[model samples]
Target chain A: MDNNIIRFTYNVDGTDFTSAGQASVMLKKNLRQLGISPDTIRRASIAMYEGEINMVIHADGGVAEIEVSEECITIMLKDSGPGIKDINQAMQEGFSTAPDDVRSLGFGAGMGLPNMKRYSDHMEIESELGVGTTITMKINI
Target chain B: MKITTVKELLEAKVVWGEELIGKHVYSACGSDMMSDVLAYVKDQSVLLTGLVNSQVIRTAEMMDMVCIVFVRSKVPNQEMIELAKESGIVLLATDKRLYDACGILYSNGLCGNGVRRG
Candidate 1:
């Protein structure tokens, strides 16, 4: 990691399903401009995208922070929604807390966390029942 | 297949990225479920869906897709169109239903990337 790395932040709004993936889009452009490989950009963007959607749907919106360095791209998502009761169950495919409305809009299939984990080199979830959840994912460039 | 060919074949209207008409795409997938599209990891560049939302454009953008065809007479709203333009994704709308639209493209050489399975 270099001291001169670029960092970006986004304030995700939860009220609009139509605006959920904005952070991922911006991050993709930033990575591309940084001369990261397309494969690396895709991995990081998709992981962050899923996390962004989760923040909007499950949490009442959140903040997304991206830190770019020589070694890896790290995305941190913090949300003040009801924390997951069981992280294990939430990680399962098809286990979603999103309502039927979200499914009709083309999401909430319960693959959010799984897809994030699949695309990133590492993922960590820290949550408290009533407090909130913070997810940190890193993809090595 | 060229995106222009897709537009002509489906009698579609372009909502954005007119300059991408000549771009080539080897594979495509049709689904309203963004998760399903994310599950399938392949070298796909076209997305056909009945779902009209900003997430659709975002999904295509993340997958590095060059074009998105909205089937079953679905039309994207202003926000979605703006997003697609900004992302440089070609957006097309067709009156053809999802199955028929996909069938036409498939029969004409656009192959599905095949969804992921556990």
Candidate 2:
């Protein structure tokens, strides 16, 4: 049988934390309708949700592309912001650059990237200081 | 345990999803940190937390949790309740503290979704 492929693009708004996880929520619904396994959907949604939040908190905004096929689901998030100066530092838990106000909102614990890495089967990050950041994550179905 | 049983066990007030009380939940997690919840990957259906905010509901939705229990007498506002309702997640509030509530559930056969570290 030929594999079914689906693709979706989301425009993330970084200024509003209230609307950050909308993309992931919608993607979860779409995946459920497509009959993906609950575990696969949860991992994909959680990884993408963390990426979405990072885009809003660190970057001004960003773009998310999700491609779903029989073999795997791929997510690419690109943001134009003050790129990560130290990738190692950013990856560490409890090391966050977020302002105190962001922490009050229940995020900015420096666990976003780490959670994304934990949930996805594979992950890649590309960034440049003052330029932008791009993260690619994939989960095998 | 069923969501209804949780409500009864904790003497929780139902904030939303009254219809979902009969739903079964095999595992649960209690935490104030959204990132910690995201870090642990499990098929847990219930979340018990003291943190009151929109992210709590968002995290539960992202994880596909069926219900949220607000511990320590924390009451969620309309916005948070609305978000939970939209996600079809049952919301409950209890006077019990986080540790006590988790213990009650654990003793009643609710397992935690263990954390994964590498």
Candidate 3:
């Protein structure tokens, strides 16, 4: 726990798709108040947003924690649901297991993890078959 | 181009942010899939979509987009409108379809060539 690091924790609710992105929206506001760069804020916000949506769609919700430091911003998402069977396949663009209804809502397009990785400087995913999944992503400030 | 110009080009009805129409935008992208929008879009100030959801507003907010145009006359619900209002993102609805709305805006100088960054 560095003195300069600020942490935020949020509980993402999987029951409601309409409220899926609330965490990301809050993070964006908090980052702006901290006077972080807009690009950095956008990157962090977008990456976390995709993660938030994933948790709701696939993981039945999760806990998201964001830590801000002088070096970079780190996002940690943990979800308890059907874990991804193949991380590599899940990482591939256009490879989604989301139901058809999710697609109608403008998500579940198989771009979540890829988008998270694309926006962040670094990302790592850890998942177990029936246990859960944890994703860690970092964005350089 | 100005938001006013976008409104005119697409003949869009401002669902919200009428006062903000004076704002200017440089680039725009049209996508119903928020995934692709998050994946490839950069510095895109406007989003045109047929998808109606609060996530759409959240996606635009995440991208720092200032305006959203709902093509095919799709009306956003109250919750979505509130979210957009909170984010200060303008909302516009048009009777034109997605392709037609995008074509009009592109032909009117609102290019999709967003400034890319690595």
**Which candidate wins on lDDT?**
3
Best by DockQ: 3
RMSD (Å) per prediction = 1.8, 2.0, 1.2
Clashing pairs in 3: none
- What lDDT score is found at residue A47 in candidate 1? 90
Candidate 3 lDDT over A38-100, as tens digits, reads: 989999999999999999999889999999999999999999888999999999989999999
**What DockQ would candidate 1 receive versus the native complex?**
0.66
Off by over 4 Å in 2: A1-5, B115-118
List TM-score per model, in order.
0.93, 0.94, 0.97
Would candidate 2 be rated incorrect, acceptable, medium or high by CAPRI criteria? medium
lDDT per residue for candidate 3 within B1-118, as digits (tens), equals 9999999888889999999999999999999998878876667999999999998999999999999999988999999999999999999999999999998888888889754334
Candidate 3: list runs displaced more than 4 Å.
B115-118
| Model 3 CA lDDT for position B99 | 93
**Distance (Å) between predicted and true CA of A110, model 3?**
0.8
Which lDDT tens digits does candidate 1 get at residues A1-141? Answer: 367688999999899887788778888888899999998998899899899999989888999989998888999999999999999999999999899999998999999999998888899999999899999999998
The TM-score that candidate 2 achieves is 0.94
What C-alpha lDDT, on a 0 to 100 scale, does residue A99 get in candidate 2?
88
The per-residue C-alpha lDDT of model 1 at residue A97 equals 88
User: lDDT value for candidate 1?
Assistant: 0.90
Give me the TM-scores of chain B across the candidates.
0.94, 0.96, 0.94
lDDT of 2 by residue, A1-141 (tens): 334778889899888898789888888998899999988898899999999999999998899999998999999999989999999889998899988888878888889999899888999999998989999999999
Kindly provide the TM-score obtained by chain B of candidate 3 when compared with the true chain B: 0.94
